[model samples]
Target chain A: MIRIFDIAAKDLMQILRDRKTFLFLLIMPIAFTFLFGFAFGGFSKGVSDPRLPVAIINQDGGDLSLRLVNLLENSEVITITQDAAKTLADYEKLLTKGNLAGILIIPTGYTDALLTGSLPPLSLEANITQTAGTTIQSEILAAANRLTSAVQTALIVGQTSSAFGPAFEQALSAWDNPPIRIESTSAVVQTGPKVSSQVAALAQTSPAMMLQFAIAGLLTCGAVIVNERKTRSLQRLLTTATRRSHILLGHYLAIFVLLFAQFLVLMTFGQLFLKVDYFRQPAATLLVAVASSLCIAALGLLIGVFAKNEEQAIAFSLIPMFLFSGLGGAWTPLEYTSATFQAIGHVTPVAWAMDGFKNITVRLLGFESVLVPCAALAGYAVLFFLLAAWRFRRVSE
Target chain B: MLQNAIEVKNLHKAFGDLKAVDGVSFEVAQGEIFSLLGPNGAGKTTTISMLSCLLRPDEGDALVMGHSIKDDQMGVKSVLGVVPQEIALYNDLSARENLTFWGKMYGLRGPALRSRVDEVLEIIGLTERAKDRVGKYSGGMKRRVNIGVALLHKPQVIYMDEPTVGIDPQSRRNILDSVVALKNQGMTVLYTTHYMEEAQELSDHIAIMDIGKVIAYGTNAELVKIVGQMDRITLTINAESGRVLEAWKKVQGVKQVTAQDGTLTVLADDSNQVLPRLFETSALNGVRITTVAIQEPNLEAVFLHLTGKALRD
Candidate 1:
């Protein structure tokens, strides 16, 4: 047992001495997180009027309803998306998932009420208890005021037109498409069942970059084993009082330390500088971090066990990094992608690690949400570790 | 009988059908140096590995400090320190750090490990540069650190497998002297080398192996007597060896003739009787003998006389 720690300490010393470890583990990941975060408008100041996402079900596909939809689309506060299949239940689900901030319903009487040149009753649904929901309420009031302005303008136009029908159509059309087309560029309004813009900024990219570079860092960590074999230190160690199991456990512990430390550093960068909400659920974050570290370390072990040299170890590490990161949604969230893609993405432990982390941050779930992902990651860790152990035994033989 | 520090039965190992260490047996007495001399692929390292418990034997077993290698590998490992042919120290770590780490692996801890590391640094004569990374050290310095790592635990039986291989003469002298110093401190040494001079100079008992089996085992004098007063006549010729080898083989009084590395060696019961015939044969074959030395029976001649080949072969 002491020998195990001795081995781990020695490996960590070697790994720390390597400047490349720092580059891969900290510098590269942080740089990519910032880059991807800015690219996706993931940072707080990177976006303006990051409107609360909401979906509209056009139960009334009338002219005024369409105008109202278009009017809400231009809302500086709330981004509106039309989804015929998005029921109130879907709205609730999205809200719980931290995707939709609210839901709007344009009922059948909306166009008729606009004909009378008055404020029509539009059902804006949101959980008032939540902060986002409260913010949405104020935005909804502002949109309602705009509607009243349009109605009064239509009332005055109705007198000259002699017909309420043409007047209402003209007023709503003018409201939606203004007289002077001031085509001011604005940030694209992301709506529907997706991660909230607040969460999407650093939440997605930080974890994605963390998981990706964690595997990338394996190139350095796994090379420790390859170097040992090449230098014959491993055989020398076997000639000591230490057992083979001690050696394996020691190496595994060291790899886990390297990967987990990387996670902590990258997460700290995301939390402190990027304003990612990893610490909102610190224990849950740690659960996934440890599990993911275990899986990645075991993967490094397997690579080390099979690779004949440092170059081979690097190839093994890189190939899996590309495969796992691409397949696991480290470069992109599995969400918003095709269902088949999401299914395939989960084949990699990175996807599950991302799932576990996003569940806490993007989805705003509690500790319970990360349990499945942690379990899956642990299962992968066990499988990879067992494979490494078996292969190590064969190589030793 | 003197108590032996290491005892071996018919230890054997095979990589498929290669029989890397086949039915080999030897014993090392306390405070003595036992050498396993063989050429490449002669299984010296394999035999050392089996004794060190780095590899399990396919048949039979060895005991180090009365612990069976098969039944108690950890016991054998605890008693043994192996310096492999390759420099096995972590190049990224300093000599002190490498020794400290191996010490810990050998179950040394706290002040004991630290002092042992410092002591080993002194012993290997690298105390001043102990803090420098092994990778930055010269090849000889790295080799010294490699040997230093094995001395951290002060095991009862130390296996130095070709420790002096591939080093400058000065460093090789330092290592050979350090090895003698270890034996003087009452440590048993199992040294392996292909260099017959090293074996002849160091071994109290020498085991010469070829193709996985020990062909001879005895003290230096005893093994040399197998050549029975034969003298080794080494001649460097101007002509190629392949041209004169067959003619020299038929010469009277020439026991065995082997040509290697631009030099020809002739074993004869009497150098006076064979020197003339060998010259006549070489002259007839249009070969000019450049240099000649007739030396007394040695391990090389024992190897040549017994195996009909050079020890280097």
Candidate 2:
């Protein structure tokens, strides 16, 4: 209705006039997004390859140990460190200091043991606290498996086919090279919404901070409501031909538009500058963003309706904001949290919004993949909006 | 028969145990300024709110322009404009912006809304300052804009609940004049104020309310006649004595006399006749009259007579 638009226009004009509101809506969200993005090293996904540092203590000095070291270097996961020359004690000290991912200690006679078909006494010293240690250990096991298989095949061929020495040598080389091999068919499949280092750091940082600042931005909306009530503008409005719903819709529309626009600008900035791929599915991202802003703004309206004064309004806006954002994993990814905590985090709409964003930015999924999160957010928006409307009508009457 | 612009019948509202508006009843004939006069906490605002369709009556109802406030609130609201006690204009918005928004709320649109906003801005004498934000204006200017918002619709009945409260004298005068102008233009107005002088100056019909009830209701002259002709005389004498008071009571037409310090006040039927005798009596008593003054009977006296309390009390 024209009346609703008039009310919304008036509220937006008031919000724009407030400098503190402007800061929260755009400036603070973008600043925090950038801060978190760079801090998490998420922006370096395509820029550079980051490898873990590990020491290979090859006391064996055998051909197998040398080949193992070569495998470690070529894997692109762990770079061989010169610390391998130090004793195990020194390597353990480096791991404890958080500088080394792991140390691969190939004992002396490792190749002879492998040639004799004996299990070698190999030890890996690693700091399991860092995930890179786990990754490096896996790479080591895979390399060892390939080498052991090759050696066993050579031995079996030498025994069964008693050709001459030169023929045997040629057969051993052929086995290692493999004239016909079992080819692997591989394609990267992302299960659910997930974030990778390749995903722009802003991918998570922008939505998280936008969710945070959207709630924080309620300070302006709550203040407007309280101020209007104090000035008796709300009571005066009731005396006009305007319905109470019209007045509430006006306020609701203002908060929704402000928050949605704030999110769009920040997400766009992230995509343009920080290389966050929120625009991978622009329409889906916009849907999630709109739903998220609606839910957040509806909550802001409820706070405004319940608060009697400006001080109460501030407290009402802030306490719930911090509690919900902190619990819902706005400051950290829910995926990294304990299973129990992730379940609890899903109780807040922030988690759903983050999931929807991660689907597009990290998994690079299509619109259908984000529907669940977007719908959950919309449900919350509807619930909050209904509550806000009921309370608004009660207080106004 | 002249049509009544608004008819309030036995309206009552209670908050918890406190009866805010208790069985109050009155009517405003079309094209008249009817004033609800009361002191603070006298329920004037509550009564106005009920009639304006902002508050529902607990026991009764009122009809504004034949629209029932209880059932047809939207219809009643469309026909009535309310100026509350507080200056309800948004400080962040310009005068024109506030008026335009309010005009739309009152169902005006497009060119009609703009023209009406312009008309109200001119009427409030703030057309030149309409572009400026209300916060930058003086308190009086903001009050004018507040009233201007209510006038945008030009409704048949306007309810002003202490519209002049907490503003400059000039602004109060301007608002009072506007109310008179509204009545002259054949619009009915229900005005409420705690100031007795404002009620006396503006109302064609006055209802004095107290403790959630209408204590008295009639025209100014009719209400003034409640208290018979009586004048108060204060004599600042050079001497203070119970004997001087007794001697003044002996004078003709002097009904009551009380002396405090060097001043003696005499309540008499006719102050002019009592003055000459008071001078003679004072000379006879060797009480030198340093100064003498007489007070006229007005709304203050009428209120005191009817309620046994001063109008400002």
TM-score (chain A only) for the predictions, listed in order: 0.66, 0.63
For candidate 1 chain B, the 10 contiguous residues with the lowest summed lDDT are B304-313
lDDT of 2 by residue, A163-210 (tens): 557555643553353211111111111122223354545566888888
| Best-matching candidate per lDDT | 1
Q: Per-candidate RMSD vs. true structure?
A: 11.9, 10.9
**Model 1 chain A weakest 10-residue run by lDDT:** A179-188
- Tens digits of per-residue lDDT, candidate 1, B1-313, equal 4499889899999998799988998888888999999889999999988888888899998889899999988778878888899999889998888888888888888898888888888888889998888899988898888888888888888899999888999999989998899899989999999999999998899999999999999999989888887999999999789999988889888878888789899888899988988888888888898899989899888888777778773
Query: What tens digits encode model 1's per-residue C-alpha lDDT throughout A80-192?
Result: 76666667777666654556666666677767766665455667666553334544565665665566566668576648656778766756654563211111111121222
Task: Give each candidate's interface RMSD in Å.
Answer: 0.9, 0.9
Task: Quote the positional error of residue A92 for candidate 2 in Å.
Answer: 26
- By TM-score, the best candidate is 1
